[model samples]
Target: MKVALKIGYEGTHFSGSQIQPDKRTVEGELLKALLEIGVITDTETADLSSSGRTDAGVHSVSQVVTFLTDNPRMALPRILNSKLPRDVWAWAYAEVSDDFDPRRHAVRRKYRYVLNADEHDISKMRDAAKLFIGEHNFSNFAKKDKNNPRSTVRKVEKLDIRSQGPVIKIDIVANAYLWNMIRKIVSALTLVGNGTRDIEWIGKMLDPDNYEEGIEPAPAYGLIFLEVQYDPEPEWMIDNYAIKHTNDFYTRESNRFLVISTILEQFVMQPEKGQDLD
Candidate 1:
């Protein structure tokens, strides 16, 4: 039987999401748990795959992974959570078709970049985000790995920037993303916010020949895999309650922070050399 899993992880401790021979990873921990439950004997024969790989220190709220198992005694979510580390949790599972491939069938993937733009210009960051909305060759925005043969051109469905006090959230939805693509974009926006780069700098970087080397990618800790979407099929049953609850929580907390932020901004903008009446 093939099982689809909705998993969440605090990626701060792992090397990355992919399974490594020696280093710790989300995939490694998951496979270890599966082995403990007698789902598969070894990595050689295990048919496990993830929606996509997240870089080291990156986090995930709802990552999808799938694996094949023959053990009828294994109750997936219960057994996996028992054996997995405290930082990783398997929330839900379901039987998927034999032909299902998380990487291939995914319709869209959304990522959120969290930034503490305490003293930076939020408007500049939002303006910079506009450059990434359409389909374009993002070769300069991603690290080119030889293993990936797919083109860098991708359709970005949405890119929005919003601020709540010191935290600036960049929500991006796209069909797919290349390695380090989101991070590089975040780095560029930071430069713009700091007045070091202008809107034209973004245009220049997108030019094939003007792409410069050694542009640093943003830190991985601020990035999160917000969600993934698959094509709507009759057999797919989504847990709407879980989705609504999570989004509602984020929305409430975001607004609370924004209120506090606005109050602080007012104080900062007040004249410091005014004559005191007290």
Candidate 2:
């Protein structure tokens, strides 16, 4: 059977999402678990695909993946969860078409950055987010590609600011992102919120032709892959039972994930040890 999976992970410990030699990585761990659980005989024949790539230290709540598998049984998510490590989870799965590719079918991607709101003005950040609501050139926000360059113009569907007790969550939805793009934009928005930079500075960065310098990217720990939206809603997503089942899975994870406690430990204890559930 061909299967699609909804995965969530704390990325603090992995080198990045991709598999590389001699590094702990999200994809590597996942494949290891799959092999051990008899999901596949070998990595080369699994035919795996992911919705997108996430940098090191970036978490995910609903990252998606698809793979061609011969396993005939259902409830793969629950089974995969059993074999995976504590920080990585497989929450939902459904049979999918052979042609469905998570990367190609996705229409939009959502990311959220959780920042310490105690030191910044939330009102100013709200105003600044409005400036990014349309298509703009973001070359200045990411690393320049000298060898194989892609277009810098991208569309922002929405940018929302939500405040909690001491944390401010900035949610950004876009067609896609360039390398370090969200971090750079968050760095700019934070400066505006902190009253260190004028709002016009954001407008200046939108100038299509010129790529500016010196805007530092935000810490990777604060960012997360929230979800992925598809062009035509997939059949698996329309199932009410799947929705309720995934919700139940999420609630179970919340009780055991200890997301907030892990972040606090990173802030208070030895972050260098990298055992804080990456």
Whole-model Cα lDDT of every candidate shown, in order = 0.82, 0.83
- Cα RMSD for candidate 2? 6.6
Backbone clash pairs in model 1 (N, Cα, C under 3 Å; residues 3+ apart or in different chains), count:
0
Q: Candidate 1 on 88-133: residue-level lDDT in tens?
A: 7776677888889988999999999998978678898888888888
Residues 136-210 of candidate 2: C-alpha lDDT, one tens digit per residue? 888888867789799988899999998998799999999888888999999999999999987888888877466
Count of clashing residue pairs in every prediction? 0, 3
Provide the RMSD of all predictions against the true structure, rounded to 1 decimal. 6.3, 6.6
Task: Name the TM-score of candidate 2.
Answer: 0.84
* Per-residue error (Å), model 1, residue 239: 9.2
